[model samples]
Target: MLPKPIPPQPGQESVWDYPRPPRLERTAKRLRVVFAGTTIAETTQGWRVLETSHPPVYYFPPADILPDVLVATPRTSYCEWKGMAQYHSVRVGQRIAPDAAWSYPRPTPPFAPIAGYVAFYAAAMDACYVDDELVVPQPGGFYGGWITKDIVGPFKGVPGSWGW
Candidate 1:
């Protein structure tokens, strides 16, 4: 059974109200990622994917990310809604976070706007922010959702949440 969703306060959103198929929407919120004392990415032109029981996953356009920081990896994963995803390791100076980011080179039609845009795992980074609010990584390492103050959930990725 699905867990009870937290009641959202004014100006907040509840993830349980999000749709099953996931919706990809453009966002002008300043998204930033920092690792190893370097600002690896910062973008106002980003997309966010929202699905039930999950926090939003922010995607940054390729131009906003530092090119040298991403090292392409052979890893790939299939998502039922987004299509195939390619992984990348994030490297800054001597630090490396393997498979810390992912992108879709060719997404399903509805998600085409995010093609080649990258999304980083907040858990793997020193910090990630939406506007000025620091992000909390989604509960599990498997999902790349960014949990900010304005979002509420009895989110997925927690133990006993798999069947949600």
Candidate 2:
């Protein structure tokens, strides 16, 4: 059975209210990812993907990321709504997080805005900030959503939520 939806507080958004197939929207909020005492990516022009039962996944423009941080991996995954995704490892100084980021190089038509954009897993980075607030990594290693104060969820990535 599907989990019951949580009612969002004022100023908060419930994941249940997000669309089923996911939607990409431009965001002006500051997004930053830090690792190994280095700022790997930062942007005010990121895009966010919102889907039912998940928190928003922010995708930063390639130009905003520091050069040489992302190294492509042989890993790949398929998303029903976004098409094939290519995995990337993040290396900052001597610290390396394998397959910690991903991008859809040739996304499905509806998700083309995210093409060549990179989304990092919050858990893999030392810190991820949305605006001025630190974000919580979405539950489960496989889903790369970032949870913030304004987002409410009985999220899909939690344990025993595989059927969701």
Candidate 3:
């Protein structure tokens, strides 16, 4: 059973209200990812994917990420709403986060705008910010959502949420 969703305060959004098939929306909020003392990616032209019981997963345009930071891996995964996802390892100097980012190179029609756009796992990064607010990584390693103050949830990656 799904846990009760936290009531959202004014100016906040409940993840329970998000749609199941997921919605991809372009956001003007500044998004930034930092690791190993380097700002790996930052952008205002980012996109966010919202799905039921999950915090928003922000995607950055490939052009905005620091060059040579991402190295592709052979690993891939599939999403019912999106399509095949390709994994990438994030590397900066001697620090590396393996399979810490992913992208859908050829997504479903509705998700095409995010093709080649990258999404990083907040847990693997030193910090991730949305509009200057530091984000809490969504619970569990399997999901890559970023939890900000304005987003409320009994998020899917928490223990006992697998069946949600």
Candidate 4:
């Protein structure tokens, strides 16, 4: 059963209001990711995927990420809407966050805008920021959505909300 969505207060957005098949949107907002005391990625050009019951998953362009920071892993996963996905481990200094990032190298047509763009798991990074606000990682390890003050939810990936 789907959980009732939390109503958004002024200036917030409800995840339930997002689309089912998800939509990729280009954003000019400043995006930042930090790990192991280093700012590993930062960009003003990024894409975000919004889906029903989930917060936005932001993707940064390849040019914004630091060189040699991403090491491809053998892991692969499939997204019904985005097609095959590949994983990457991010390393900075002595820290290694395994399978902490992913990309759709050859995305399905509808998601082609995000092809080769990398999305990181907020929980796996020391910090992630949308503009100046720090993000809260979406609940549950499997979903990489980043939650900021503007997004409201009884979001998916919570214990009983998986079936949503």
- Candidates' lDDT values, in order? 0.96, 0.96, 0.96, 0.95
Superposition error at 127 for model 3 (Å): 0.4
Candidate 3 lDDT:
0.96
The sequence of per-residue lDDT tens digits that candidate 2 reaches over residues 106-138 is 999999999999999999999999997999999
lDDT of 4 by residue, 103-123 (tens): 999999999988999999999
TM-score of model 2 vs. true structure: 0.99
lDDT (10s digit) by residue, model 3, range 28-123: 999999999999999999999999999999999999999999999999999999999999999999999999999999999999999999999999
lDDT of 1 at 64: 98
lDDT of 1 by residue, 30-104 (tens): 999999999999999999999999999999999999989999999999999999999999999899999999999
Residue 101 miss distance in model 2 (angstroms): 0.2
The parts of candidate 4 lying over 4 Å away from their true place are none
lDDT comparing candidate 2 with the true structure: 0.96
